[model samples]
Target: MNPKSCLNCGHKISDEFCAHCGQKTDTARITLQSLIKSDILGSIWHIEARFFRTLKHVLFGPGRMAMNYISGKRTRYYNLFSLLLILFGFNVLTLHFYLNLNPDEISEGNSNILEFFSKYSKTILFVIIPMLGTNAYFIFKRIKLNIAEHFIIGTVSLLGILIIFLFNDMVSLVGLWKPAAKIFGILDKASFVLFILFPAVTYWNAFKKSYSKPGLLWRVSVLYVLMGIESLAIITVLYRVF
Candidate 1:
């Protein structure tokens, strides 16, 4: 047949998709049915599919996934920051609605800090990204990834950690039933231990191939120590300021 102009970029093409911009050669009019079925639902399904696939890779092989992403094989994975933000939002909602613990009930010294974090959890989460990124950049300098690429791995590790916390929040909902309340209570206490080990475990899994087992362990250890110190400094400054 004859060539037609691509509506998206004015590229001339005769195939089903424009060679220059990839817009479809056959465009449909925007009717209500097409908008709902093709635009809204299609977009939603696309995003959902990518999100779950990305989560599976992140959970099972975060290191390989991050390496793939850094090496430019990124189309298969969801955007790291986007996934982190989505999971963070869900975790926050779970904490607020399902596991709403009172700050006053926490230990005296930590109550204020807990309250502070509860109020500004999103901001705090974003702030922690850079801190984690910096620590990883330094600890894994031998890996040959730059600071920005290190940040990408940091984002993936943080996403895995958040998934752990999200699981804790979800399982905490089991406490609502009187029959499972005691068991969930035990699980709730165990969550503290999970929080401590989860990050190190995530880092270990993500960097296992990059270093020797012993070397990876020490680097992961130092990374957490640095993170703890940085967190303590931030909390101290916050306490003095507000």
Candidate 2:
């Protein structure tokens, strides 16, 4: 029976919900249909719907994504690591399959396909996260971020920089004219700064629990230098190994 008085506002109501307060007069018991509709299907729908919102938060809000995730507002955005992995996987596959043809064999196609695969497959891209994040953890050690957290920051930073790299890859694969390629080649190389600067900007926004402007700049700059050194070291090592 519908309660004569609403449980929430004590307003007289003959229906399931209180007219004024909108609280239900009866305690709604869970059913399989409701569970499937509201919990299971709704979760997938929400995540799918919020994909661009998550990207916008990462792109426009800087520290907002990390703050929301760390503060247990997971449903407000997508999983940070999950998004990172998807982008990384796509990047890896695109590089390997689509854009990694031998420049020397542009005329003959991949006649030496095995040789190309060997060199490309041995790429040390995995060192990216550890290199950036390790220095971040140490630089921000006063705030006591864990390795995983630094990894998240590094991942987000790389995601930002990867946009440029992906664009560069697309331009390279599209077979631009010689002069155009020369111009973009310079841009492609110059974009390496964004690799470091993106994280510095992100951490500046996020790691502000106890830092003034100058202090934060100093710390993030230190992280940038350290990460840059690590990137150079990794590239040197890869050159030697491959």
RMSD to native for every prediction? 3.1, 8.0
lDDT per residue for candidate 1 within 1-242, as digits (tens), equals 77889989998999999999888888768999989988999889988899999999887787778778989998888888888878998998887766355333467787776678787667656766688888888888888778888788777777887887888888777677779989988887787687677667667777787789999989988988898999888877766766
Best by lDDT: 1
- Error (Å) of candidate 2 at residue 10 is 32
Q: What TM-score goes with each of the models?
A: 0.82, 0.63
Model 2 CA deviation exceeding 4 Å by range: 1-45, 93-123, 171-193
Q: Pairing residues by index, what is the TM-score of model 1?
A: 0.82
Residue 7: error of model 2 in Å? 27
Q: Estimate the overall C-alpha local distance difference test score of candidate 1.
A: 0.80
